[model samples]
Target: MKDLELLLKNIKNKALLPVYFLHGGESYYIDIAVKSLENDVLTEDEKSFGQTVLYGKDTSIPEIISLAQQFPMFGELNLIIVKEAQDLKLGEDELKSLEFYVENPVPTTVLVFAHKHKKLDSRKKITKILTKNNWIFLSEPVKDYQLAKWIADECKANQIKTAPNISHLLADYLGNDLSRIANELGKLKMVMKEGQELDEKLVETHIGISKDFNVFELQKALGNKNHAAALRIAFFMGKSPKTNPFPMIIGNLYNYFSNIIIYHTMHGQSPQVMAAAMNVNPYFIKDFAESARFYPLKHATRIISLLREADLKNKGLGANQIDDAELLRELTYKILNVDRLKVSV
Candidate 1:
């Protein structure tokens, strides 16, 4: 799969391929590629007659082939785009027709398949042909652990300065939704002053995620065994169910303690080694080290069990009509005092 930049650069240099099969699990990159082809391939005057957009659900392979075979009416080339190509149902004859067209596509017509949210069937001959010719672009989803770096890269690409932890903060709040994170960054960029860096305060003000009271802060409080601070944040989070969903909080805690257990077992290793083992940034190794001191392997394992019980309770199993706030309070108390509570593993 070619990178989006390389693809756009090719189109910019007038080195256009006969066919572009943009299919993927991530729609953000796919949409960007499709838009670039739509706008960059032809001028406004040329697009009036040269450009044609078709939906996969409404068009067939034979129809696509027929269009691709035709020359441009008013411009030097014809640009044919098929959006939502994943929804295009294929039969035996249609598959053969597509494979035939891809193998010997028309040079004067540029055909693009904007297949979003899924990839082409690798088992199909057409997919193999696309790959062999470098015509396919696969936009794989970014992993949860990679979101912070992705955010940081995006900030850098936009020529924006940010605090070291700002990317991590945004990643924690936004999860792995590239489109939503990009939208929030776009909003921040609009209101940002000249030469202003994006810090936690700016993010809290613009993105609605509190600098203090978020899952990252709550994790810090728990890692250091600050009982008072943990309870305060938990209480605040419980009050705002929409912002801090109970299940997401529990899931984050589960991941936190699970990493602590891994850290305990990796003693004496370098920060980089441990960070790689835990899938966390090396900058956070010190924090994890402090957390490991507070939570031994046995304690961390037991806390994970406690988190599982809390998750079940949040799902209304054995909860006895307790509200999320109260459940959160009880769970926080148990986690902070795991040794004394003798939480079963």
Candidate 2:
């Protein structure tokens, strides 16, 4: 978040806050805030006496406050960070004890709370005080379409060059878990030369994703009306069901054509309008604009239906005769046929 970067800069400049509460589903920014405190809050000699880290399972909020009330020893600030604060065995009453500490916090102590995955009760007075004072940060998930742009930015932050649209390939394979994506990107960068441009081949080699046989490529083939290529990739998927499961393939297709269908229904809206309506990157509007020919409004609608039905079948709710691989081949065949004429599956 913008506030997070500002807070980090302030910490680096020794502009300290008495209390910090970082709660989020995505832990990337939370980790950054914690690391900033570790690196910038105290000197190497000061860290020996000025830093304390605790886990929620073993520490109480009252105990943490007591620790925070301690005076710094030969340092400008004493940093006490609490990780996984969500697991703390505390109810509203126990949490309220923090209100007193927050109201009259120690000048020498900087208390940081890394509450991962969930937020504390906002109705509580403690939450109200922290938020009003600008101490709480919630890390919202990156939008589904924004993942690629975020990945591209991350590549730059790591000093790695990436070929165009490589972020799209990574987003298609990795989903929107920023922590996991960073881990994979770190691995990919390790195997490359220092300044090598991250390409499809590098990703396929280091990240174990298929450059040619992934669902994104499958979608591209279908969008271009290349039935042979679509079927070929589907067969590759069939041979390796462990890696490419039916649900992920179906989910990707559902997202892919549903947007194309949205573009057609908008009926002559500008590319910018459709991009905003569909929450898609503006650069990809042309692909969906062209895709209207391969899968017209009527066919795109039916293909989504086929995908839904196949999803149910794979789940043993409607039908479960074939495995995911065979199910995918059938789904691809039906989608490609929708290009020729209206199809039913």
Candidate 3:
């Protein structure tokens, strides 16, 4: 699969290759590429000449091949796009039909396959088929640890540099969703000048996180078993729909406890060592170490389970009437007053 940066660069250079296949976990890059291709490569007049878009579930390979083989009426190239190509049947039964077109795709037409979701099993024969003859691109999602860097890089890509702390805040707020983070960053960058330092104040004004509140302090409050502080933060988060979601909050909490679990399992390990082991920034180690002292491994795990249940309930499964604030209050009580739940921590 080609790198998204390189693919966009090539497209800008008017060097698009035929039979391009884009598949992966990262939908943001794929979406951007598709829009770029549609807007820059083919004009409205060219689309009228010869442009076909089909879903894999709707069209047969033969029908797709036929359209691809058709010549452009009055354009440089005809475009044949197959969206959700992973849904297309690819097996021994359909092998002969697919092979015939793959063996001899039309030269004058540009065929693009937008295969979404996780990558197809590499051992599958069809995976090899696409790689052997076509231009393939994977839009995989960024991993959690790499997300902060991706956010910073994106800001730089837009020529808008962010303060270091704001990068971490955006990563925590956005979680693992690169597409949402990118969209939010686009809005943020619009209000910034080149070389402007995007600080927490700007983010709070535009994106709705409290200027002073952050994942670090949130974890610190949790570690010390500060029920009042935790509830206050949760209430503030609930009031700000733009910044609050149970999933992101739960995920950050999970990471925090995971660090605690690691710290407990290791004997006499320095905070620096534990932070490195947990893949957390060193500055956060002080709070995490203190948290480990207050919330033992078993207690932290129990609270994590409660958080997971609250997450599900809020999603319309377990309890319907439980609002975010009440749900958070319940979680806070359970975490700070673990013995009150009548369960051994």
* Top-scoring candidate (lDDT): 1
Positional deviation of residue 247's Cα in model 2 after best superposition, in angstroms: 2.3
lDDT of each: 0.89, 0.85, 0.75
Q: Candidates sorted by TM-score, descending order?
A: 1, 2, 3
Model 3, 96-123: lDDT tens per residue?
6665666677778888888788676677
Lowest-sum lDDT 10-residue window in model 2: 336-345
Per-residue lDDT, model 1, residue 209, is: 88
Residue 196, model 2, lDDT = 82
Q: Candidate 2 at 130: error in angstroms?
A: 1.0
Q: TM-scores across all candidates? A: 0.93, 0.91, 0.74
Give the runs in model 2 whose Cα sits over 4 Å from its true position. 190-195, 266-270, 339-345
The TM-score of predicted model 2 comes to: 0.91
Q: Write the per-residue lDDT of candidate 2 for residues 207-256, one digit (tens) a residue.
A: 88888888888989999989899999999978877678777788788988
Better of 1 and 2 by TM-score: 1
List residue ranges in candidate 1 displaced over 4 A: none
